[model samples]
Target: MADLKQGSASHQHEAAAVIQKHFRRYQAQKRYKQQQSATSTIQQHASRFLARRQAARDNEQEQRAARFQAVMSRHHERIQQLELEKRAIKQLGAGELEAWQARREAAATTIQAHWRGSRQRQQLKLSHPALATLRPVACSSPQPADEPSCSTRPISSKVPSNHPLLHSVTAAGVTGLHAEPSTASVAAWPAHRAGLEQQPSSASVCSGVGYSSRAAAMHGALRGEASSCLSAEASRLSAVGAAAQQPADAPRRTAALPAARRMVLERQVQLRTDAFKAAPNALAAARATQQESDQRLVHLLEQHTAAAAERLKAAQRRQKLLQDAEALHSQLQQLPQLSQLPDNVTGAHFALPGACGARAQRSRQAHALALAEAKVGSKWWLPLKALNQQLRDAAAAAEQDAGSTSGSASKAAAGALWGAAGSTGLLQQDWQQQELMWKDSWQRIREEEQQRPGLQELMQQDQALRPHVVIEQELSSESSWHAASMQ
Candidate 1:
């Protein structure tokens, strides 16, 4: 494998070039196919979009053409209607004036109703100039013939169609159509019309028309029609009545369109400033305060440091006292407690602060000094000192005298002292054993006092928890005989 790898390494660059060339060709072909597919997708989407847009445009054009056609048809129809109306008006007799009034009044009423309904549906008081344009209209529904109009216009008795009054009203249209009147009332036409108006309603009059009032008024000036003249006069009267009724300062219903409300927002910006910035001495005062605080802090820190040092010194003093006491206690153990010296056994003497043995914790190492004076006193301090003094003297005398008498004296005194010390050691051990036994008994008693309730108090558990069934039965002969015997 190593040889093959070594050989292949030499051709690595050439193989990589060939691999890269093929990969590049593959990538180019893939990219070309992808781009072509994407282009085809884009073309399909564009064509669909254009088709839809064109279809929409065509539909819109068709709808517009239909609406235009409808509008033109209506326009032509209205024109034809107006032309027919003109001819009809030219031929209208006095009776036909009522019909024209009815139609005009209906138009005005329709405009008012549309205005009112529009306002109500929108829930708004719309101020329209168009509302004021048509102030007068009347109903055309049937009314009883005996009833009177709201204006209290008197009704005249029915007159023949050929009545002279009719001829008088139609005089301008065609002359001599009536019997030659000896004398005619100039107001006959007006009185006749007023009574005819009263025949239409009791409570309401087919009052006047506001329907294309200008056009109606212009057409009323035709020279040949009596109905046209009356219509024009009626329109003039209605206008005068409307002007009288509406006050100049009448409050109008105004429209509240969402667009008309103010859309622009007003803004105001205010920056907060501090009076402290205006004062030149503020910084100086602040620095002085900070310096004062720092000084106070330094003073407090010094006090704390002194206090800490005192506490540490006190702790070290305590540790020194404990070490001294422990060392002296150990030295005292080596000294004989006898009142006299023994002849047989000599006591072991140790120098001051003798070995208390080495401890693994070296937190305090003052004991490294072997002969350093360590002060610790106990109840046996004097006795221990005296024993040490006697031993030193005995050794000195033995060295000086070198006689059998001196040696014998040292031995007797040391032996008696050590014997007493042995007696005292026996008492100490005995007391320690007794103390341990008492402590153990006390611990046992305390443990026995902690009673567990469940172990002792689970009485009548079965009868209290289990279900029971009543058994009705005769007593057995043996149980009855036992009960009789007990009684």
Candidate 2:
């Protein structure tokens, strides 16, 4: 056992070393690839930025030219406001736009309030079972005419003490059973029960049956034993009911009965109550049978469902993998010849920086809020905006100081003796396991761009083509053009 332990430890160490070797190799390859791509990625980002800046400059020039047009619009609006004032229309009075908006807001609020009230009332009706009784009930329409019905009134009577199954239903149907039996059932079942309850007067009752049953119910883990307990209790109950029906003078000799007869009698037990069988007002027997059968099936299936579901999921996963493999094999010619690295440095290694940097966030919410409150009619309003901006920049600088790897790297190198095992070294995992072992993300994105539909074909057909636009000059010059009616 000592040798075996040593051998296993050696094997584990060997596995760890091999894993580290592969990880280091992958890391070196990744770093080299990043170095190669950094130039191009940075260039692309720089070009995009410069293009956007140029576009913004052009937009500013166009806006300057449109200023004269805006002045003309203001003049046109003043003329319309003056003309409306002369009319003295109620809706067209002072603060006309505000009034229209207020009326619209009021109408919307009223509609929403009415909808909520109606919904709440409906929900209240559904929630209360008593309300269902007050609502007029028609005779049941179709489907299982023999099924139990409570008629217009729910059951509220007390059931026999011997019948536990029917007890709760008789009181208030809280057990979700029939409130009333079907037309075929006997409303009074005690007479039939009285016959089955008879047992030999000389025989003794089973001792501690009630205590054993109660204890088992409270703590028993065995399901089959619980059912046996139920059967035993039923037989005991039937014998009890029979005792009341028989005369005290009547004699029953247990010794006179044949061995076979006695054996059959001993084994015989009533499975159900008379009320439960051939229910006249409902299919109580069928429902009970179905319920038992369902419970049994559920119990049986519960043992195997988890294993079966796991197998099914595994099979589906394998099928998907195979399908993906086949598709890739078929489209080999269209696929990328080489894997490209992402220039984005965001990865698990940044987690420490994120945690450490939280002390210095961009928000100066309290200061900004104070400035906002004091801004109205203050000479320092212009300076308040600048103060808010200055605080934000200061916070950014502090965050850079807190979260940066540059400062930490120097400190870490100084303490290299104590911190030899780095985040990606002996302490942490081999690599972040992503698609194609961290390969597919960049390649797939590139492939999607290259194979993007329509644009390439359109460029080939007419490379000089540019989409033409015809803006309505009147609409741009006048905001009220939206209210224009067609002739």
- Clashes (N, CA, C under 3 Å) per candidate: 14, 12
Candidate 2 lDDT, tens digit per residue, 410-442? 334323321221221321223223223323544
lDDT (0 to 1) per candidate: 0.42, 0.42
lDDT for model 2, please.
0.42
Off by over 4 Å in 1: 1-12, 91-487
TM-score of each: 0.19, 0.14
* Among all candidates shown, the one with the greatest TM-score: 1
TM-score of 1: 0.19
The TM-score of predicted model 2 comes to: 0.14
